[model samples]
Each structure stands twice: as C-alpha cells, then as structure tokens.
Target: MKAIVCHELNGPAALRLEDIPEPSPAAGQVRLRVRACGVNFADSLITRGQYQVQPEPPFSPGFEVAGDVLELGEGVTEFAVGDRVIALTLHGGYAEQAVVNVNRCVAIPPAMPYQHGAAFPVVFGTSHIALWHRARLQAGETLVVHGASGGVGLTAVAIGKQLGATVIATASSPEKLDIARQHGADHLINTSHDDIRLRIKELTEERGADVIYDPVGGELFNASLRAIAFEGRILVIGFAGGTVPQIPANHLLVKNVDVIGLNWPAYAERHPTVMTESFRILLDWYLAGAIQPYVSEIYPLEEAVDALHQVVSRKSTGKVVITVGD
Candidate 1:
C-alpha cells in the first residue's frame, strides 16, 4: 500500500509518498480501500505539530475519507465487504486503506461522488452542530457568517438558508464574497474593502444581526458583538484568523447576547446520536439537491503537499481533496 507519511514534525512540505504494508481492521473497526481523502486546514496544522490534538510523529495526516469497505472486524454486522462508505478517522486517511471504528463510518449516498463524500463529514457536521444544536438558529432570523467562502463557512451558509434564515456572508475578497452569494447568502460583505460591522448594520437597517457565525476570530469577533442584535447569539466556530478573540462580559450584557463555543469533535463523542442524525440530514440534503459541497480542487495522492499548500496559503475557495484513485 502507498501512503503519505509525515515522519517528523517538519511540515506539510516535508510529507513524502512511500510504500508501506497495508493495515487490517482491528476489533470493532473496519478496513476501507480509500478512494478519496479530504484535505482540511487541520491537516496542515497536524503535519506541523501545531494543532492542539497532535498525534506522535511518523503519522499520516488526514481525517475524513470515502472508500469501499474491504473487511469488517469482530462484532461488526451493520456492513459488509464492498460497501461504499465515508469514514471519519482520527488519522491515517492519506493512505490507500484506512481502518476506522464501525461507529465512525456511514454509508454514502449512491448519487454522491467520492470527492464530495470525502469532504463532507468534518466541516458540514461542524456547521450543522453549531448553527442548529448550539446556536438554535431560527427561521426568518438574520444570520451573519464570517469567512463565508471557506468550506465550513459555506456549509453554514447552505444550512442557514435551508433553515429559512436570512443569511449575510462576509469574506476577505470580492470573489470570495461572490462565492458565498452563489451559495444562498442574501447579502455579501467584503471585509477587505468594507467595514464588516458598518456594512452589516446598513444591510440590516441598523437592527443588527440576530446570529453571527464566526470561524475567523481576533478583531472580527469584537466587531461581531457590536453588530449583534438584542438577544442575539454568536457561534464561535474556530480561530482560522490566527488569533483567538476574547469576549468581554460588558459586551454580552449590553445586548443580552450569548457567545457559544462550538467544538464539534467533542460534541460528536458526547452525543454520537446527534452525529448520526446530522449525517443523515446532510445525506438527504445532498440527495435532494438542496445542499451541495463545493469541492474547489482535487489532487492525486502524490500531490498531497500541494493540496495542503492551497489551504494553508488561503488560495483555495472550497474543500480541497486528494483522490486516492479515480
């Protein structure tokens, strides 16, 4: 079997393709013949040993994958060989085969392509849990999404619209803002050229947004609080903007706003039922053509470094993926 190995904490640039022995399924796990692997920003962080959840060195750096089941371990009776499925793994998704726990794999919709299936689990699941479960975003509410062109941001946009919210999307560039608009954003704000708080205020007629979905922290979070409406909720998705923002109690008291922390990985562990339900909703949405993930680019396994570069450099528009095979 061939795999991309990060033998040292050098970085994504130092990742190399090497021939390695295949791994078999362990107890309560399933072995999959990987067809596609999703390249997330966390993959870059994991390779460089910067992410909070760092595995020991000499590891493969991928999380979500779509493939065919080759074998199932003991006590696994829900699936069988050759079943097309998507697996969410802690690591080792960059290989030709990956072993994931039976509880972590889900059957992919027959109509969904491998590229999109590979990219779906993490970002879409995170967005759904944040907006629906944590934030309790209601229909007809005014919703603001920061970094709206990225994978997680766009997923929020799609889900917000589907739930009947009036979605306002913000991006660093006009092109990215346009991408958000195409994904059902009711209004677009280019934070690079326009002041986000001011633009959002004007767009909402000075009432402010009912909910703010932010993956980009730092100064933007402060501004999001200022632009929040009375009794608004702010969903802290991630700190993709390099700095984690601090929320002052005074600001929260002024508008009665709630700043909710959304950690999907932790939530998935505590509430496995919700994770399954979220995947089911996403699969139904994909089948109905109501929500589709935007796969910006796909690279071969050998070009995994380039794929990571696209994300780390912020040059990629949507989810970037690595195709293990065709």
Candidate 2:
C-alpha cells in the first residue's frame, strides 16, 4: 500500500510518498480502502510535530476520509465489508488503507460523493456541534463567523443560516466573501481592509453579534471580543490565523460575554452518541439540499504535501481533499 509518511518534523515538505505495509483492523475497528481523505490545517501542524496529539516519527497525518469497508474486526456487527462510509481516522488516512474504530465511522448519504463524504466529517461536525449544542444559537439572532470562506468557517456560515440566525461572514477577499454569500451568509465583511469591529457595529445597529463563531484567532479573536453583544456567546473553534490571542478577562466580564471552546474530535469518544446524532442531522440536511459542501481542490494521494501546502498558504477555500484509490 502507498502512504504519505513523515519521518521528521519539518512541516509539509517533510511529507513523502512511499510504499508501506497495509494495516489490519483491531477489535471494534474496521479496515477501509481509502478513496478520499480530507486535508486540514492540523495536517500541517502534525507533520511538524506542533499539534497537540503527536504520534511518533515516521507516521502519516490525516484525520477524516471517505472509503469502503474492506474488512470488519472482531465483534464489529454494525458494519460489513464493502459498505461505503466516511470515517474519522485520528491519523494515517492519507493512504490506500486505514483502520478506524466502528464508532468513529458514519454511513455516508447515498447521494453524497466520496469526495464530499471525506470532507464532511470534520468541518461539518465541528460547526454543527458548536453552533447547535455548545453555543445554543437561536433564530432571529445575529451570528458572526470569522474566516468565513474557509472550510469550517463556510460550514459555520451555512449552519448559522440554517439555524435561523442572520449570518455575518468575514473573509480576506471579495471573492471569498462572495462565496460565503452564496452559502447563505446574510452580510459580508471583507476583513482584509474593513475594520471588523466597525462593520459588525454597523450591521447590527451597534448592538454587536449575538453569537460569534471564531475559527481564526489572533487579532481577529481580539476584534471579536470588541464586536460581540452583551451576554453573547463566542465559540472558539481554532487558532488558524497563526497566533493564539491572550484574551483579557475584564472585557468578557464587562459585556457578560461567554467564551466557549469546542474540540469536536474529543466528542467521538467522550460522547459518541452526540457525535453520531450530529452526523445524522448533517446527512439529512445534505440529502434535502439544505447544506452543500464546497470542495475547491482534490489532489492525488501522492501529492499530500501539495494538498497540505495549499491549506497552509490559505490559497484554497472550503475543503481540500486528497484522492486515494477507487
């Protein structure tokens, strides 16, 4: 089997394609003949040994994939061989085969393509769970999303609208803002030049956002602190902007702002029922055309380095995937 191996921690350039032994499933797990894999910002960090969960050197870096079950492990009765599925592989998904726990896998909607199923689990799971469960976003409230054209950001925009909030999307460029608008964002903020605080103030008639969805941190996170409404909830998803802000507690106190952080992957094991139900809702939304995935680029498995580079360079929007096998 072919896999992208990282033997040293040197960022995306360290990823290399090589022939590796195929893995077998353990108890409660299943082996997948990987068809497509989603490349995330964490892939860049993982290859460089900067992510929170660091596997030993000479490992593959990937999280989510769409594939067919090649074999079921002992005691795995819910799935069978040849079942098409989307799975959450904590790592080793950028390859021809990967072994994932049965609980981490979800049956893809019949109408969804392999590429989308690969992209679905991470981004959709993050935003849907954050907005619906964590933040408790309500209808008619103003919802603001940062990095609103990128993978998780775009999903947040779409889900905010679906949950009945007036969505304000902030992106670095007009083209990105346009893409966010197409995904149901009611207002667009070009943060490349516009003042994020000023724009939110203008859009919300000076009250500020009711629920702030922030995946890009650093200065943007700081701006969100100023732009959030009184008693508003701000969902901190990630620090994609290269810097993690040291928030001032006094500001949060003054506005009665609630800062909530959601690490979606943790729920897979800690609360598997909630994770499964979240995917079920997303699948139902996909089947009804209520939500759509935007896959901007699909690279072959061997080009995993280039795929991660595209995400690190901020050159692609929505999700970028790596095609593995048929």
Candidate 3:
C-alpha cells in the first residue's frame, strides 16, 4: 500500500507519499480498498499536532473516505465484501486502504460517484447535527452562515434552506457569494467589501438572524454577537479564520442568545443512534436531489499534501478530495 506518511508534526508541507504495508481490520472494524478520501482542515491541524486526538507519528491524516469493503473483522455482518461505502475514519484515509469501525461505514447509493461519496460524511453530518440537534433551528426562522463557500459552511447553507430557514450567507468575495447563492443562500453578504452586521440587520428587518451557523469564528463571531436576534443561537462550528473567539458571557445574557459549541466527533460517540439517523436523512436528501455535495477539485493520492494546502489556504470552495487509485 501507499500512504502520505507524516513522521513529525511539521504540517502538510512535510507530508510524504511513501509505500507502506497494508493494514488489516481489527475486531469490529472493516478494511476498505480506498477509492477516494475527503481532505479536511482538521487534516492540516493534525499534521501540526494541533487537533484533539493526535496519533503518535508516521501516520496518514485523513478522516472521511469512500471505498469498497475488502474484509470485515469479527462481529461485522451489516456489510458484505465489495460493498461500496462512505466512512468516517479517525485517521489513515490518505492511503490506498483504510480500516474503519463498522459503525462509521454507510453504504453509498449505486448512482452516487466515489468522489461525492467521499465528500459527504463529515461536512454534511456537521451541519445537520449543528442545525437540527444542537441549535434546534426552526422553520421560517432566519439563518446566517459564515464562510458560506467553504466545505461545511456550504453544506450549512444548503441544509438551512432545506430545513425551511431563510439562509443568509457571508463570504469574502463575489465569486464565493455566487456559489453560496447557487447552493440556496437567499441573501449574500460580501465580508470583504460589505458590512456583515449592517447587511444582516437590513436583510432581517432589524429582527436579526434567528440562528447563526459559523465555521469561521473570530471576528465573524463578534459580528454574530451583534447581529443575532433575541433568543438566537450561535453554533460555533470551527475556528477556520485562524483566531479563536473568546465569547463574552454578558453578550449572551443581553440578547438571551445561546452560544453553542458544536463538536460532532463527541456527539457521534455519545449518541451513535442519533448520528446514524442524521446520516440516513442526509443520504435520502442526497438521493432526492434536495442536497448536493460539491467537490471543487480532486487530486491523486500522492498529491494529498496539495489538497490539504487548498483547504488550509481557503482556495477551494466546498470539498477537495484525494483519489486513492487509478
């Protein structure tokens, strides 16, 4: 097998594509002949040893993948060998084969392409759980999404609309804003040239947004504090903006807003049934054409580092993936 091996926490630049022995599944796990892998911002963080669960060294750093089942370990009976599936792995998705727990693997539709299947799980799951379970976003309410052109952010915009919220998307450029609109953003605010607070206030008729889905925190979170409606909920998805925002407790009290910190990995463990339900709903939506997974670019397995660069540099909208085989 071939993998992008990281022996040190020196970031994506230090990642190297090297030939390595294939891994077999342990108990309750399945080995996948990986066809495509989703590249995430967390991959970059893991390379720098800044993410939550750091593996010791000389490991690949990919989370979501789509592949064919090669073998199933003990107690794994839900899927047969050669099942085309999407899975969420803790790591090791950057290789030609990855081992994931049986619970994390979901069968993909025969019609869905491997690239789209690879891109689906993490980003869509994050948004679905954040909006529905954590924030309890209501229909006919106003929803604001920051960094709306990025991976999970774009999913947030689309899911918000599907859930009957009036979606307001904010991005740094007109091109990005256009992409947001195409994904169902009812209103667009250019963060670079336009004022987010003022535009959101104007668009919402001064009521402010009912739910703010934010993956890029920092200054955008500060703006959300000011722009949120009374009793609004701000779901902190990530700190992709580079600076982590320190939430002011007083601000939450003033408007009775809830600043909810959403970490899906923990949620998935605590409520495995709910996570499975969420995936079921999302997969149905995908099959029904109610949601679309966007892949901005796809690189071969060896260029996995470049895919990570595209995510970290904010050059790619939606998802960037790595194709593991010919």
For residues 96-157, could you state the per-residue lDDT of candidate 3 as single tens digits? 99999998899999989999999999999999999989999889999999999999999999
| Candidate 1 structure, TM-score to reference | 0.97
The TM-scores of all predictions, comma-separated, are: 0.97, 0.98, 0.99
Give the winner by TM-score: 1 or 2: 2
> Candidate 3 at 50: error in angstroms?
0.7
CA lDDT, every model vs. true structure: 0.90, 0.92, 0.93
lDDT of 1 by residue, 1-326 (tens): 99999988978888999998989888899999999999888898888888767899788999999999999999899899999999999899999999999999999888888998998999899899888888889999999999999989999999999989999999999899999999999999888878889988999999999999998899889889999999999999888888989778998998899999987876556789988888888888889999888999989999999999998887888799999966
Q: lDDT for model 1, on a 0 to 1 scale?
A: 0.90
**Model 2, TM vs. native:** 0.98
Better of 2 and 3 by lDDT: 3
- Score residue 209 of candidate 1 by CA lDDT: 97
Models, CA RMSD each: 1.2, 0.8, 0.8
**Stretch of 10 with least lDDT, candidate 3:** 262-271
